[model samples]
Target: MLYSPFLVTLTLLTLLTASARAQQSGPVVATPQRPPVTEQDRTEAQKFVAEHHPELASLLSQLQKSRPAEFERALRELVPQTQAIQRSKERSPARYESQLAAWKIDSQIRVLMARWSRKQDPETETKVRELIAHRQQLRREQTQAEKQRLTEQLQKIDEQLQNLDQPETQRIQAEWEQLSRRATIAAKQATKQKTNTTGEKKTTAKKSSDQQPAAAQPSPGSR
Candidate 1:
């Protein structure tokens, strides 16, 4: 199985970084100001939206006319993902499809988050949680798939080492060791990040529940 190094590295870095905690936190209510979107960015975003997500294209069109700031923020968020998808398609078609599926889920989650931000209702919050859970499952699937591919690669490398001289064997062993170390670190980091995310989510949920007055709280079946 083929894998894009850039995409792999990007994913690993995201999982390994301290910022991953913030990235995985509760829905951001405020859209942070980004640098102005250039004409080139808008054009590329339009092209990408038209090709991959017609719904987003319609949303973008409406935003452009009614909310220019939102239009820029959406475009800024989209263009990088669009570029990443394009690169994935070029490097690995199977991986591209997987990434695209995740991206679609991400898009849905974003839409739900926006709705929740505007009005913190139970139905929208429930949908957002469902999508987040689905996205996490997809990430697990991707990680498992990558692990299988790496196992196959290691097996091939071992076979090759058996036929090679001592010098070549040493070089292959070094390469294999490096790959093993990286995989080990990535696995550890991912596990830690997931634990933190779950804890944060529980904390956030508790706070949200506590903030609501008991008199105004809906029944369990109401959701």
Candidate 2:
């Protein structure tokens, strides 16, 4: 049957729309990836860690365990796992970003937990375990719930810092400023007060030593 040109054009357009919809229903679009961390970026991140959280300097300085390197490894390792979510996202792009955000959140939590892991105290160790357990819950959470919980955890940490003394306050603030910038901020914070104490002792010693000779001097009556 002969068809009008307008009818033929309309038919082609209709077929294209159906094909596009079918593709949408069968596979989620893979997201454009963020650039992976570079060696220079790693070095900068390392320097940032040193300036902001130097205690991790040694552990991270090994060149093998740096945050950039570790994060790069984690992103690579998470690839297969993200792929597993492909089937679930097949229905919509909305789900894809949601899944990605959840994955990112999970990764961030792990990074945070690792930083908190070097504590030598048993009580802190127990709290770390509890923090980890809640993180696992965060992973399983719905998007809205996870975000709310994330906010709550962050605020709780902030409140804990508020309750701490000035030295603790400074440490927590410094570390938070470099969440992804360092891997050892917490460890550095833990030693901050002690380090300040050492500084105080050195100043006190100098003052005492400076006075010692004068105090030991011969009096005016001494020949």
Best by lDDT: 1
Worst 10 residues of 1 by lDDT: 11-20
The runs of at least 3 residues in candidate 2 whose Cα sits more than 4 Å from the true structure, single-residue gaps closed, are: 1-76, 82-90, 120-223
Overall lDDT per candidate, in order of appearance: 0.70, 0.51
Candidate 2 CA-lDDT value: 0.51
The candidate scoring highest on TM-score is 1
Q: TM-score for all predictions?
A: 0.53, 0.24
Taking the tens digit of each residue's C-alpha lDDT, what string does model 1 give over 94-210? 999999888777766654565465468999899979988998999999999999999999999998877574687788898899999999999999999999999999999999999
Model 2 per-residue lDDT at 65: 33
